[model samples]
Target: MPSLRVLNHAFRAWRRNRAWAKHEPETPFLADLLSGAPTCLHVGASDGRHSYVMTQVAPKAVIYAFEPSAFAFEVLKLGIAWHRMGKQVTAIHAAVADKPGELMLVTPKKSSGRMGRAYAYVAETKPNGPARPDLEDTGMETQMTPVVTLDAFCADHAIDRVDFIRMDIEGAEQRALEGAALILDRDHPHVLLEIHPPMLQARFGGSGEAVVDLFLKRGYRMFALDGVRLEERTTLVADLPWKDYFFIHPSRAARLPDGVFKARMAA
Candidate 1:
């Protein structure tokens, strides 16, 4: 077995790369959320890498990460146990879908590491057509597994509210939200969502704006769009095409202090 120091270093490296970008150009929205040390719910947290960050920043808060992939769930559980944070962190072996039950979890045969249903959209829109390509060439496979909606899971677990939510469920954001209407209506947590426009349009017949509209109608405000566009330092795209967006409830906007806001502006 690897030494404890070695394991810690390895876990840190994995989080730095696979988790949210630590050095990415900061935005007021993210700084605001991180500064508050809020309780969070992470949807489709494949291996709970980002969940680690949440716990680090908010040691007193609770985090529930929902993941369906067996391999990913196993590793995530190991990471949580290794850190002795089994109490602060809760890992669920379920995917966020239209309902609480089983569904297909498609992944590349060779690289189950990058498994996600969002990839299904890419598969469906492949230029050649809709057919399972060679595993080596495509690096994915379509497998079935049980999925559950966040709302149902929360209800079953007796979770009353969430302060923040991070969703990266491939292209299943809309469905997840549809099932989480109660949480959105009652708890009003800040949400950080990754919306793949092409995938949303191709697979779900929905536009990215529709997802944004869902939150907007529920009294949430778009705070920032973080990712490639900021790093590239170019004006070509003008708007972020492929990236993560952060949204927060307007009522809680005052929780973000001026110092945090200034730090992000400097970044």
Candidate 2:
């Protein structure tokens, strides 16, 4: 049996953590959008932790969180329930791919809260001892799960429009965009995409520049968070040599400061 005081302390800790999950870093980009209380679609929502913030920012906004991993699905469901956001947030057990159908999604058994077949992280190489000492030492197994395209899922669910979209589908950003052609062309939702150029090139035979071209052709501008100015010459470099970068659409360019969107290309 736990003491009453101990139980109360534990409850308080839980509440604090839950609050932290919904509000941390205080992103200026999101803060600007929250003013509109816009509906959001969160792709690659690992456990609904970040999605929880959408609810706090836009109390009336409906949030759709898409995730496919079984373990992550369970965690997201519990997180939604724990946060008591059943009405405000929805958890979709699906992966955002290039088409609207079932596909195998490779999920690593040991993930650092982010892993996907679409985005393959480079294996740390070690000095040659055996045929492949790294492979033998790490022994990481990839888990496959069912995946579907974002467009198909949205059409099936009758979600015609979303005010904001946040995608962090590992390295599947390009394919996910391809699947969301209709939404991109018609609704033109404000998009926040996480780009993993190295993974994109190594796995999909596509380059980050190609992905940027696709969005730019579709009337989207790019931006970097943390108040960095976007310039035509300024490339999207990962914080670390091989990390990830964020891109924003042009229509929502105003949400970011003048320094962020570079020189505002025609939307």
Candidate 3:
């Protein structure tokens, strides 16, 4: 029965994808968006790999890359300095959230002496449940980190206009957006974000569509990153129960690459 159940899921996912597929010059979908923008905020910057890529593509753009993990921030800084991107990319050692305060971050337990460092996520309060085995692997531990909202950060820094934002801070997209209401309304920047269906299901009693809805309500359209262009999705499909989404505000939609709608979406 278990084997049959496994087969059943594979078949369903296969059937669902009867037609379709889902990086970069490091990240292709973002090239156009960043080309015209002078300032970009890269939330969940990890070790600054993508931040570096962005700078390479848009050398003049100032990238404010944020990574909450101390372990990760060190690496992020090293990448920026090693590449001599110190002048273009600023590595911020903090988390972007809906509010400015301390929040608990869950990461793999180091005491286990495991060879791999677990992917860390902001541990949400209550009902959301703990991180999954694959994410927290070998168990999880908590470390407190300071978090700030995009709005507050922008205001405090006297940044009047923001053009692009790439945020993928685990499952905290919704909460982070809650705190970014000011930026979204004022800056109207283009965004690239990762939506974890499991994270929504486990933490928000919702699905990936809910995440889409959140952006839609904010006057953004969802698109899957397709090579050098943006492919708008009338129906949201999750390739691996998780994927990144490009949220183009109406103001920026006019700048999307041509040939984006060439192929029809599989019905």
Q: How close to the true structure is residue 208 of candidate 2, measured as C-alpha lDDT?
A: 73
- Reference-based lDDT, each prediction: 0.64, 0.61, 0.67
Give the lDDT of residue 210 in candidate 3: 66
Work out the TM-score per prediction. Answer: 0.74, 0.72, 0.77
Report RMSD (Å) for each prediction in the order shown: 6.1, 6.9, 10.7
Error of 1 at 161 (Å): 1.1
- Give per-residue CA lDDT, model 1, range 154-227, as digits (tens): 88988887788888876678777888888888888778777766556655566677788888788665645334
Which candidate number has the best lDDT? 3
Ranking by TM-score: 3, 1, 2
Candidate 3 lDDT tens digits, 202-242: 65455677667767887776777555455677456645656
TM-score of 2: 0.72
Off by over 4 Å in 3: 1-26, 109-118, 124-130, 133-136, 204-207, 225-230, 255-267
Clashes of each: 6, 1, 1
